[model samples]
Target: MEIIPSNGEIFLGKEQSFICKSSVEATMKWLSGDDDEEIEDELGRYKKELIDETTLTLQVTASKVEPDRIIKCQAETESGETTNTEIKIRIIQKPTFVKDVSVTKVFNADSDAKLPCAVEGIPTPQVTWFRNDMPVPLLPGHLSATRDGTLTISKIQLSDAGMYYCQAYIRERNEIEHKNVTVTVNAAPMVTFEEPFPKITSKSNASFTCSVTGHPKPEIVWKKGEEVVSDDGQKYILSSNGLQLSITDLAKDDEGNYTCYASNSLGQQSTTLTLEVIDAPRGVGAGVVAGIILLIILGTLLAVDLTCYRTRRRGFLMFLSTSILGRPAPRVKLEDDLKKGTSDKSHVVNISGIDA
Candidate 1:
């Protein structure tokens, strides 16, 4: 006896048929596995047919068949000799996922995360990970996958949060299965500034603005030195959703290191900046007073020259000399003294004889 197409394989829940042909007329029967248990047609579990005196057909359901089972064809010839041919059945079970598996995972920044795909099959399937429809690269210390369909990512960041796809592939069977997983990563507060430290003048208000970013909206706190700053309406004020802290009526005491602290459920962060309070300017300086006095003196000298030109018809210097010396000597007397006085030139136009 010989079994046609000796190798037998079938997918789960499907039916497979086998034909056994004998060289001579004989009584044919089917037996299962090593025990040689006779296969019967009872309850329709298996179907058996005889098309001719030498050919026998047997049908079996894969779901009812055991792994690596052998179906043997036995032919008893009229000469009382038995001939046997057998085929081994290989059953293939498609990969299927277990029930009640979690598809979403949440983690904080800088933390480790894992996603598990619970699947089972006759032949183990290969598990791979993909992020945003692209394959996830497996790094030694960063991202990795396990044979049991679990993906792990180390030191996760905000950028790592997204949709992840887990696929179970059986290459030989040309079968594929996938599941979507959502990874959520939350971060702590991060503080930034446009102007790190500011210089403010005394007697003017000082404003320190803080820029912060985080998940779940972090809480903000302002501190001066070791003391917490609060809104007192007149002295301290907080606005712009508590991102800005303003100190009214600034003074020298306000100059120091001020801290802006931000915190969330994930973590906390802070930044410190110095507040420089310079003294406000005082009244007019000495240089300004000196310039004013110099301008006044120049105006007085110009006024005296104008007055002398209009009233005495003489220059300011000449008028000043006449006022210091007494009435001037007459021009005619001065000329006569030069022509007549030869004995005493000092007697020329004596001040005592000059006309008043």
Candidate 2:
């Protein structure tokens, strides 16, 4: 007996077949290893078929194939002699992922971090790493990979924050699988000012803002000397996020050294600003004083005019009273004129004499 396709390899879950033939009619049997008992034929997995009176075929699935397993086809004639041929079966399987990589990882600056990916299958898969769709090298310093397919990073910085991927490649099956993870690096607060030292006019509105950068969103605070600034009343207005200080109707007292403090869980930072308030010009002040003095002089002149008019009117009244009643003329004989019933055109009489 002769077997067709003496050796074969197939992937798991696939079907493989071998044919055996003899010139004369004979009973066909299939055996595995050196077992005396014949191998039983199953319906789908393992099957035995007769092609004519002399040819036999054995069909087996990759799931039934074992390591170093050999199948023998034997033909026994009525004379009690046997002829046999053997076929070797090899099983191959595709790569499969056992553990998926982490979806996301977070680390502070100057810290260490790791990403993991694991896989299992026949013809062991090889693992590779990538960052932001670019291949990552297995280097000695900064970034490296461990034997178990773990990507390690030392002293992580802000620039290292990005998307990372792990890939598993199987050469025999020509298959590749991938897992992705996102890494974030947190940093401390950094404070800066647009205008480091600002010069503003007195009695005008002024606003100072401190720009901040950090992760976890730093909290902002404004300080002057030992006192912390807040929105206590209308004089000072603090921004909602506390990054700005607004002064309405600014005065000379508002001018000073101001400090902005930005802090978070990681660390804190500060920036100082010197505010110079320039007073109004001397010429403008002098004009204002001259205007006030002119108003006072005009008011004094109005008062004096009113007083003089009142004094003149009082003197005129006194003179008219004295002319009418204070002067006494000689007494005329009013009584004699009345007795004579004579008409006297002009006669003067004293009031005391004419009482009767």
lDDT per residue as tens, model 1, 15-62: 878899999999999998679988887543578998888999988777
lDDT of 2 by residue, 65-110 (tens): 3575777888899899888888777776666566656577899988
Per-residue lDDT value at 231 in model 1: 89
Residue 224 local lDDT, model 1: 89
lDDT score for candidate 1 against the true structure: 0.79
Backbone collision count in every prediction? 0, 1
Error of 1 at 124 (Å): 1.3
**Residue pairs in collision within model 2:** 332-348
Compute each candidate's TM-score over C-alphas. Answer: 0.52, 0.53
